[model samples]
Target: MVDDTGQKQTPNTLEEPLDLNRLSLDEQIYVNMRNDREFQGRLHACDQHLNTILGDVEETVTTIEIDEETYGEMHTSTKWNTSMLFGQEDGFVLVAPSLRVG
Candidate 1:
């Protein structure tokens, strides 16, 4: 099943339930990130650095925090240019990296 977006949802296994309401805020963010094409690409690249990753076909959530300087660099990286187009006028913009389903 697909959410509001046209992106197809991954099928859930017997161990995983097909319910969005049960998802946490972080999980929801991860799903939206996965649906975005550009963010998806970035996640694919960063997946290698993530540890203790866990998730099924339908969804996954990973926690990662970088230093303030590194975070700033990441924000300015060329990979994030497309996101900047959305404009920065709004305060407290929340961004989640896309899922790198393997």
Candidate 2:
């Protein structure tokens, strides 16, 4: 199938009730954390404890600012790349490599 960018992509064969730790092995994963931080990376390892090791990772941090006069919110995001990083279970908000935000 083709993705939004019109590039052909392989479909994931994992069934429902997926085993995340197993699915992530050597695969690109998307991670959401509690502090408005998100990560996309190649999953190197993870344990049942949710401790994860990622490689060639890109990390995004989102910030929201409230406008004083208009009472509106402005959202901004910053991204950085890391060769390797570790994420602990307690920091995770969501994890699913194949699921995209729709």
Q: Pick the candidate with the highest lDDT.
A: 2
**What overall lDDT, based on C-alpha atoms, would model 2 receive against the true structure?**
0.85
> On residues 1-102, what C-alpha lDDT tens digit does candidate 2 reach at each position?
776688775555443434556766888899999999999999999887888999999999999999999989999999999999999999999887755456
Please state the error at residue 99 of candidate 1 in Å.
1.1
- True-vs-predicted CA distance for residue 7, candidate 2, Å: 39
For candidate 2, what is the TM-score?
Answer: 0.77
**Which parts of model 2 are misplaced by more than 4 Å?**
1-18, 99-102
The global C-alpha lDDT for each of the candidates, from Candidate 1 onward, is 0.30, 0.85
For candidate 1, write residues 1-102 as lDDT tens digits: 775567667644122332321232124233233322222212211121121122322322343456686563222222322221221212212334344379
Clashing pairs in 2: none
On TM-score, the leading prediction is: 2
| Superposed Cα deviation of residue 69, candidate 1 (Å) | 51
TM-score, every prediction: 0.16, 0.77
C-alpha lDDT (0 to 100) for residue 24 of candidate 1 = 28
